[model samples]
Target: MRTLITIVAFLSFGLLSEIQAQEKHEILSPQEFCDKMKSDDVQIIDVRTPKEYKNGHIKNSTLINFFDDDFKEQLSKLPEDKKILVYCRSGNRSGKASEILENLGYKNIYDLKGGMLLWEKAKTDCY
Candidate 1:
């Protein structure tokens, strides 16, 4: 009974750690997101539609429309090792994109708090 108890506790701890590791998603304000974008190996993704993207987007951000039928597949093409920063016109779509990225096994996920609207209000430069 003692040995069985020890094994169960060890297994439980391992499972807990794994779960914690997988829950590495974060939401960042415009300023915070800008700061994090400076880091190396970061992949900035704009989840807005092509029209929205063409209007304006963060410099160097890749377009991956959240509504696209192949959205998940497009996301899967990104390098899993890099940190992913996601945003949309408003915060809604980006939030959903961040969750999908997490579920798809991209470890480092960051969502812009208020998306492009807040970003523009914050006076952050866009391209």
Candidate 2:
């Protein structure tokens, strides 16, 4: 019985890991995100906290912090019809946020590959 339980647990963990890996957001390079942003009706979202946003962010990007207590409430304000380009300080939070956005029925969700860190490395201009 113990052996059977162990086997079940292992299989469950493996399956869960596989599902999470499959559900991860697609990572886009800085230039790829930039090109997409140039198109009309694209929405640039900074998923960093308000403090991080105040420090610096992409020009014309709106803040909808992924960690905010009212994150879902704020996210509801974003236009569902537009493509969303989301970024954070190091891409971790933005990746998670993109997944959430996808689950929310967003069709065109994008994740900044290295987050704002790579954007800054590419010397892209920000506000």
lDDT of 2 at 49: 84
lDDT of each residue in 1-127, candidate 2, tens digit only: 9999999999999999998766635678998888888889899999898899998888889998787888877776789888889999998988878878777767678899988888988854332
For candidate 1, the C-alpha RMSD (Å) to the true structure equals: 4.6
lDDT of 1: 0.89
lDDT agreement with native, every candidate: 0.89, 0.83
Clashing pairs in 2: none
Worst 10 residues of 1 by lDDT: 118-127
In order of appearance, the predictions have TM-scores of: 0.79, 0.75
Q: Give the best candidate by TM-score.
A: 1
Q: Cα lDDT for residue 79, model 1?
A: 97
- Give the residue spans of candidate 1 off by over 4 A: 1-22, 124-127
Residue 122 of model 1, lDDT score: 92
